[model samples]
Target: MTTTRMPRSGSLPAVRRAALVLLAGAGVALSPLPAQAAAGGGGPSSAAVAAAPAAAAASSAAQTVVSTALAQKGKPYVWAGAGPNSYDCSGLTQRAFAAAGVKLPHSSRMQSKMGAPVSRNALRPGDLVFFYNPVSHVGIYIGNGQMVHAPRAGDVVKVSSFDRMPGFHSARRLA
Candidate 1:
């Protein structure tokens, strides 16, 4: 005796239908791709992958620099020393950068010698900006025209408006 199977109503061939469903699901899952990745049609686009780490690193660095600076707020101003007790303008920047694994010189004048000079308009969080006619003071630019610095001998480290500060010079990026 011979036996044969009958096709079910509205049902597709088992193997082909399963494969189609899987493909459709996959297509749906990957639909509406992110703008950075959409150029490649599917899968992770080069731009998206590349930008993610760069953005993350930049954010991490910014956070590290800001937090490091803020943490030292209220520390007395000690000349030429980057430490728990005190810091000068450049010294605070140096220690903050050091906390983020970037090394910098102890003096503002010396620190000014390193890194490309960035204009005030281009300043970003973590960029070091100098002040005073002789570049005697330095501060970490915290964006929005503000900087964290050891302002004076009596005053502790604090954030202040860069506009109000004197002798605005250039900025240095340690990262």
Candidate 2:
């Protein structure tokens, strides 16, 4: 197995370098351990290297989903409204994921069951965070314990702290 070193810090912008490092970590995290044996050495196998691009793709998709949802910030939260204008909780998530080429149901309850269940400690940007016992509300997590959500009627889409929201039922990762 061969390894490549990252470019010197001076060669890349801080943000770009950080992203590369994070994506590389993501690749390792996503790679199946069983495939590491194919290399016959200590380094990542070809299978792990191949999985890197997939991790990058998923990262990009998650960014898109988060950005698309954030772009709607301040839009009125109309019940069941999905769109270029207003949005409901699920509508916002559905449209946001749709922008990333992933289809999600318009109901929070149904959408909650569509992705891999994620633990609170594992929450990442683009993970769906649900609230209430029966999961009546949903939000797109944006990391740092913050989430973007469309609160009920008379409210607008906004970034909110998890501490402000009650009844945290569960979370899921779709991207």
Best by TM-score: 2
Residue 35 CA error for candidate 1 (Å)?
A: 33
Candidate 1 residue runs with Cα over 4 Å from true position: 1-57
Candidate number with greatest lDDT? 2
TM-score of 2: 0.67
Residue-by-residue lDDT tens digits, candidate 2, 40-119: 11212234323322111237657777777777777888999987678899999887776654557789998888667899
RMSD in Å for all candidates:
22.7, 16.6
Q: In candidate 2, where is summed lDDT lowest over 10 consecutive residues?
A: 32-41
User: Per-residue lDDT of 49-143 in model 1, one digit per residue for the tens?
Assistant: 23322111234444566667767766777676577677778778776665543456678997886655677777777777887667788888776
Give each model's clash number: 0, 0
